[model samples]
Target chain A: MKLGVLFSGGKDSLFACWQAIQKEEVACLITVVSQNPESYMFHTPNIRLAALQAEAAGFPLVEVETAGEKEEELLDLKRALLAARERYGIEGVVTGAILSVYQAARVQRICRELGLWCFNPLWLADQEAYMEELIGAGFTVVIAGVFSAPFDESWLGREIDRRTLDELRAIAQKYQVTLTGEGGELETFVVDAPFFAQKIAIEEASKVYRNYNGVLRIERAGLVAK
Target chain B: MILVVDLCYRDGSLSRDEFVAPVERILCRAETPFLTRHYTAVGAPDLKSADAAILCGTALMDTGYMEQPELFRWLLSFERPVLGISSGMLALAAAFGGGTEPCCEIGMVDVNVLAPDPLFAGQEVFPAYEVHEHAVRVPGEFVALAASDRCVQAIRHRSLPLYGLLFYPEVRNEWIVERFLGLAARQSP
Candidate 1:
């Protein structure tokens, strides 16, 4: 079956795309860019870079803009799915939802309304095992945003290597946070994946952090030959 | 050992991770032993060895398993404790002459327990995750255990340990699966 993934330039969505490609034909990557940084449904940090990731993975991208209003964002998502179905002839949609019923339910409804099948590969996944697989599968993920405490500015733009994962594991146990950041405690960006023909090179970036809330905004990035 | 049945469209399908793995994870955390096999691949040895069985759900649009009701006829005689979820529930009902109706529920729903059963002994009303396109008609040999405002949420055999839930208990309701494991342990040798 041909499917379109809801890409957010984050590890979860990209990882979901990887899984979808392995099982079905990932015809395109659909992204909904929200203006509100506090949007609950969409990932905000460096979301514009989804196009570059899509290009690296050799998939068409369907980009949609949303004002980020509560319910209006869902309408924008529906529009995006319609566009994907029209352009790519996708039969279903894939999501990276891990444990958020709020996000999963909303997306499920939209897909049902569109008469499209929805699949959440990472739904209710074991967090630690998922993180281990993400790293073991040669996915180079870096922390893009941190929303909760126990995470300082030093974690910005930090690649999730073994050492970083170890630290996160300890923090997860001590701070009551999810290891894969499913609770909005952190956000991640994949610079390179096993499926990527090229890797993302960060040319210029800036960090905006205060009181445990921070984002590594990628001001300039380009695809580089791996 | 618990037999975790995969009810996806095909063996090792993409839907396996979404439907089967979560339930396996709950069992893993509970330190329970299990074996998984696709519905088409299950054999007599699997039924003979499993102390209990949990038939996992499938994607909403994937009902290929429902087309072959004979594959599940074994459930009628297996007699061991069984828990069928969502699409698995439909299959379980079909094995006993029950049919499905057009009742679509997606996302979190409030379920009200109507009967006194160990599965929901303490809980009266609770939220559950549902992603089914149709609701099973309560089989003649079974009684409705719980329900949402729209449709029946749970059912169990009048005398057997067979049970069916129209929701995915792996999401935020892992306790239910754990409780079922506890029940299965007590009923098993």
Candidate 2:
């Protein structure tokens, strides 16, 4: 009667978990943390606050630390996913894989190895529709990181909105950045979502632009219980 | 035909992170104006489910689907449309007609092509950015759209909307990025 959802604190993962709570019964959320300075398999840096995300989703959090290399990271993830399935006695694995086969294939492989049902409710949906859904569902997300190109310091603290979406779309058309940032042209974090039990409240934040690398870096993300 | 090179692959794994840029380059370049997901391997994401799909390249060529062979089989079943570049191109070549052989490896280079095309637009030959080692031998039925002096650079299937290429058109300069995306931009997602 329970399932484990991969929680990323992004529009897709957060929304996936919310849908699981509504459409199926899920007990807890499992996330993987690769502490390495550069991680290929994990979401982003400073997600240590995922504990905060766990609290908001009303689920327990479990994370596995990864070090060195993507294959190694996937191996660690497979172990964590299998252990979570066993320890939680969960019947299914829920994912937010809309387009990337990299994450979906790995999750499916792990679920198969773990003998659990794999559910990707958002799989293959239209990117525009998904973005509209995130906004329509009341999720507030912001840009978190940017490579020196495509986007720079000016993009660091930008909000995800019609204008930002428009910019991303224009950039994709003009420069080839996908609307979803799936290609790593950019990445984002959701500050709040429709299912949040408590909104993530930041006392104050600064968009410190790293001029050399020149990115608006977000720091000091804190959560407040509703 | 479209070519996407995923920087997320092995050698391109700058400081142990790759796969993302190459795919991002193609998607950003393609700007298909649709929701996109990332799949671990060739068939993992089930491209057949979408109205149209683009396959990004990989780091190293692996054995079989890094996820499932069924997904590639599913893709071949699709008559709608699909674009494959680099590793994606190789994977689709195997699925639609037959196997792939080694060609120019990773990194940037100029590509030469011949013949008129649906995807390539018009021009005798153009310099598309290059990546990947695999060269595919297209089925006789699939028309060869573009080719370098060394190999078959691009191919389109006779009966289906499927296309594959050996290079990375998305890796071209910014103007080409917009121009390439313009092909699919008007179509509804």
Candidate 3:
């Protein structure tokens, strides 16, 4: 069945999309421009970049902008789904909700309201195994934000390594943080994937550290082959 | 300082997984101490010395405790403030009342707080992310602290050395966590 994968430009969403394409029918990519997503608000942050993901996965991009919070966010999503369902005739939707029911429930509700079946490709999967599957599938996912107190600015721009995965497994037991960053502990972005015809490369980047968190901004991003 | 009572078969529950890390986070947030112990290494000093206690959930039948009775008796002997999540709540109920019946598994369900309770921290209404399978009816005298749209979510022995929580408040959300920390901090000193 043709499916619309909700693309957040995050590693999980990108992986979800790839999973759908693997099943042979990813029809489109959708993203929400949140007013308070901790990134750009006016437009869907990283979606202008999604043209690359669309090219990578050979799918069309649909950008939905919600310039406010919660209810407005839901409304924006409903509009996007209805349009996608009508235009693409999508049978189902795929999402990347690792442990937060907040996002998953909203997506299910919207799909129910729109007469679309909701498909969460990554629901209830083991956290470590999930990350491994993401990396094993060959995606260059990077840390986009960090709110976990134990993490530092030095972690920004550090490619997710096996060591980092091991560290997440070990320290997560010590601190009770989810391996998937479910509590807004951190955010991520995928720069490359197996499905990508071309990969995202960052030439000019700067890391800015703050009291509780930091961001590694990619001033320049371009498409390149792995 | 805090004490954790962990007595259960492995893998039937996940509360013990979050039990230590969670209290440690709250203690770290409040600048308190986090402790650990083994069933073999501990004696009365391990529990009676703590400001509060946390009992990790278990799927091991209360019948085992009844068969042995000594360990369960020792656990109830602590008389320190207690917080029970999942099977821990069953243990608390069995400690005062009787055993639990096997019921439908519960997870990702929403819980609404019934107020004038310390765990809820005076909120009129809010959501709790639940991940449990079974719960016991509170003893006749215990007060219900929180409830879902269905069964009892929590119970507390009024005016005593115990409190029981059906939800893992530590990882539930930041708000309930802040409330749990506030009360934990007050109790610490």
Candidate 4:
């Protein structure tokens, strides 16, 4: 099956893309840039950097712009998927929905309406195995945004490794949060992955903290040889 | 009053909570009270005190039986209402002398309910999320309740309140769990 992946420059999306490549032909990576930071549907943290990530991974990427209003942004996403189908002749779209029914159901409905198959390899997948596989596959994931308690400014710009995963598990157990941060508890960025021809090198970044919530901004980054 | 058994493949370093989280959230949404236990502790689960028990899915198949022989025996001897899902369904089948056939059917597949059951109350046919290479065969003591083109999707004991499903109800929605809880609450003393 030829498929388009909903890429967000995050671990879940990229992992979904990687998983799809195993069974299907990934036609292109689709990224939706939202203007509204508080958009409920799409990921806005470090989203603009998706272009560089796509370049590093050596995949064709298509970008879509959305005003990011709740419920309204889905239309923009639909338009993006449709465009990918028309341009690349994609028969399906893959997503990295581990535990978000809100996002999965909406995407599934859109795919159904568009007559395209919906693929979610990470849906309800074992979080531990998923993370282990991601790491074992040589993907360097990092925490890019923190939205809940038990996570302070120090958590910003932290690379996800065995040690960090252990700490996150402890914090997740204590706070009763999703281990994969599926409940808006956190967001991630992929610096390097198995499929990448080049690796993302973060030369400059900033941490923006506001009222127990914070986001790590990638002010500058470039792709370097792997 | 519900018991959720985490049927995760114990690798000695991971918590099975990730597999149980969806079931937890379903109970939370339905306002149904429930308790959770790991598969290792299934040997002596407090089944008498709970209204029902649910065996969640796992990534590994051999991890289910090889890790806990006593638990498998307990489930075979269990008389209370039990629901098995995916690898859980495989465990139930193994305990009943029925074995799994190596036939992979992963992803959404159409399922047809052969008879009226509480788990699939209102639905006659629906799409289910399947992720298994081995499909369970119907034991003599149990009857097949639902089936897809490739495999038997569900099974039920002849006289006991036991059920097994090859699909994950926690995927698209928790209607299956909600219905099971309703039946359980009514069956509770």
Candidate maximizing TM-score: 1
Which 10-residue window in model 3 chain B sums to the lowest lDDT?
A: B9-18
Position A43, candidate 1: lDDT: 52
Model 4: lDDT of residue A157: 92
lDDT by residue (B33-110, candidate 4, tens digit) is: 888877776545376566788888764322544346557677766677888888878788788888778766655779
Clashing pairs in 1: none
List of clashing residue pairs for candidate 3: none
| lDDT: the better of candidates 1 and 4 | 1
Measured by lDDT, the strongest candidate is 1
Worst 10 residues of 1 chain A by lDDT: A36-45
lDDT per residue for candidate 3 within B74-153, as digits (tens), equals: 54566556676566666677777745554433345566666477666656555665544466677875788777767777
Candidate 2 scores an iRMS of 14.3
Window of ten residues with lowest summed lDDT in model 2 chain B: B9-18
Q: Could you give candidate 2's per-residue lDDT for residues B1-189 as a string of tens digits? A: 232323232332221112334344445445443444444343433443345666665433333343443446756666656677666777777776567676644334445546565565655666665544468878765877777778887777877767777775544433433443554443425
Off by over 4 Å in 2: A204-219, B1-189
Model 1 spans with C-alpha error above 4 angstroms: none
lDDT of 3 by residue, A116-168 (tens): 65655565555777789877778887877777778888777777768788887
Tens-digit per-residue lDDT, A1-226, candidate 1: 9999999989999899899989989999999999997789885799999999999999999999998999999999999999999999999999999888899889988998988889999988888889999999999999999999999999999999999999999999999999999889999999999999999999999999999999999999999999
Task: Kindly indicate the candidate among 2 and 4 with the higher TM-score.
Answer: 4
- C-alpha RMSD values across all candidates: 1.0, 10.9, 11.5, 10.8
DockQ of each: 0.78, 0.04, 0.03, 0.07
Candidate 4: tens digits of C-alpha lDDT, residues A116-154:
767666767767778888889999998999999989999
Q: In angstroms, what RMSD does candidate 3 have relative to the true structure?
A: 11.5
